[model samples]
Target: MLEVLNNDWKRLLEEKMYLCVSIALTICSIVAAIVLTNTMQTKGNIAMVVTDQSANTSLSKKFSSSPYFHVSKMKKAPLESDMVQNRYDAIVTMKEDGSYNIKTIKSDDMKKMIVGALNNPDSYVPSNDKDREIGTNIMGYMMMFVLIQGLFYARFFAKDKEEHIIKRVVTSPIAFRKYLFGHATFILGMIFAPTFAVILIAKILGVAIGFSLLTYALLIAVLSILATAFALFLNSFFCVADTANMIGTATITLTTILAGSFYSFTKKESVLDKLVHLLPQKDFINYVNALEKGHLSRNIELQFIYVLVISAIFFLIAVMKTKRDYVYR
Candidate 1:
């Protein structure tokens, strides 16, 4: 296994340009998160609805001036879909009396910010623990790119099959399992290392990541394994690198968005809920949100277990596919 892993890394090292691009993209996303967290003055996005055309704009301007809010003055109320998509953190209907009604799907922490801003316009200080975990924010931004990298990295495996290299290895004394494990390990490390390092360094530098270092490490580790498994599963279906890559890229992008990697929105109906439940990223991000609350619930355990089970199942299927299609055939 070690020998195979070594050979795989050596092959990957030959693609210096690909490695550079991957590293740059991964690190840039993390660094951008850190920079924004440090620099952002507004803690929430609020849509202020004024019913009267001649209404005083001062109330809207007051909320907009507060550090806790980026207020959008709207003649009409924002749509429910906009709230769900996180375009607005909260919707406000302000009366002439200085009182307002707020509707939001965000946590109580965000609700407090809105209330405080309404009461004193100057009172709310952003909490050290932001409404959502910074760790989760990093994951939302970084996950799709890292997973796409996994699909591309597995091109090495696809290339071997295309060039008849895998056929020779399958017939050789070197076990097929070891050869496959080597490729999987290489892909996982390529996906995990730089991404995790950025988080670790940020934590060391006193960034409020909203979770323990150990928890962040575990999250990234699981995500990396799942990404590697996902890549292998797709590649197993199509020996041609381009076809597998195209399908895998589209699947990852769509599923990641639906999973709420960037925004967590609740569905009202059973069918939509069930469809989202099928996605592994949904459970993964749910677990991240759970950890932000600083308690271990049975639901969190289930989400964690679901993510691991899905990753393992993907790998198991890939193994079966290789034995049936490549080796025995």
Candidate 2:
């Protein structure tokens, strides 16, 4: 296993796969963080145009007090056309009974947030959790980066097969299981490199990661193992490097989207809700969100158990496939 690890390390250096991908993804993660920060500010701050002053002074004051809204008194009538154009996030009209009517182009989450603030403005505290926001943004892109890197790393297995290196290894004294484990370790190391790099880069850029360093390290380690196992399972289907690259890339891309890595699915009855339970990416992001809320104790156990179980399952399958395809051959 040590020998195999050394050989894999040398090969990885020869290819410079880790260096290339890590630098590329580090830049991407930084850019993604900046973009998300700006976007979330717009999406999070509900701009309100209040047209009725006589409705309730205290209620209007409460609305403005809530951190979720930016309330301003409008001298003129509120127009739905302007709201549709996104000039304003929402318009709150005062009724005679001191109630309010809201119109906004925001999504369900944003709408719920607005409604919640209006109901109890005094009890509402605007979330200033920059750590959580930055953490989620970084983790989201980090998971996507790991998945894409896995696709490329899987090529090593396929390339070895095509080059008859697997055949040569089989005839040697080294056990095939050790060889496979060595390669899997290499993949995990490669994936982890970029994850750590992103964290460092984020810290240097003054992005708050929310969680303690220990927690972040553990999360990254588990996720990297899961990604490595997933890539191994995916690569087991093809002996040709190019074929694995094409199919694996396409498969991960679709799965990432469906798993809500980019845009979240807000509706409860949507098809994505049913399928998201089966995806690691969904659980990974959920764990990050939970961490932001300081709910890490129970969620840590859950995420660890879930990720480990899934990683073990995929790894076992990959091992079985390797034995059938390469060991016996």
Candidate topping lDDT: 1
CA error at residue 325 for candidate 1, angstroms: 0.7
lDDT values, one for every candidate: 0.80, 0.71
Predict model 1's lDDT versus the native: 0.80
Best by TM-score: 1
Error of 1 at 70 (Å): 1.8
Residues 203-256, candidate 2, lDDT per residue (tens digit)?
677766655667777778888888888889877877788887778778777777
For residues 1-329, write the lDDT of model 1, one tens digit per residue.
77777877788789777778777877777776656656777777988887674247566567767876788887899788897778999998887766679999765567777887777765656665544556677776777788888886899988887788888898888899988998999899887887777778878888777667787778888988999999898888887889999999999999998777775554445466678978989888777877776766997889889989999999999989987987888
The per-residue C-alpha lDDT of model 2 at residue 111 equals: 66
Segments of candidate 2 deviating more than 4 angstroms: 44-107, 114-132, 204-207, 269-271, 296-300
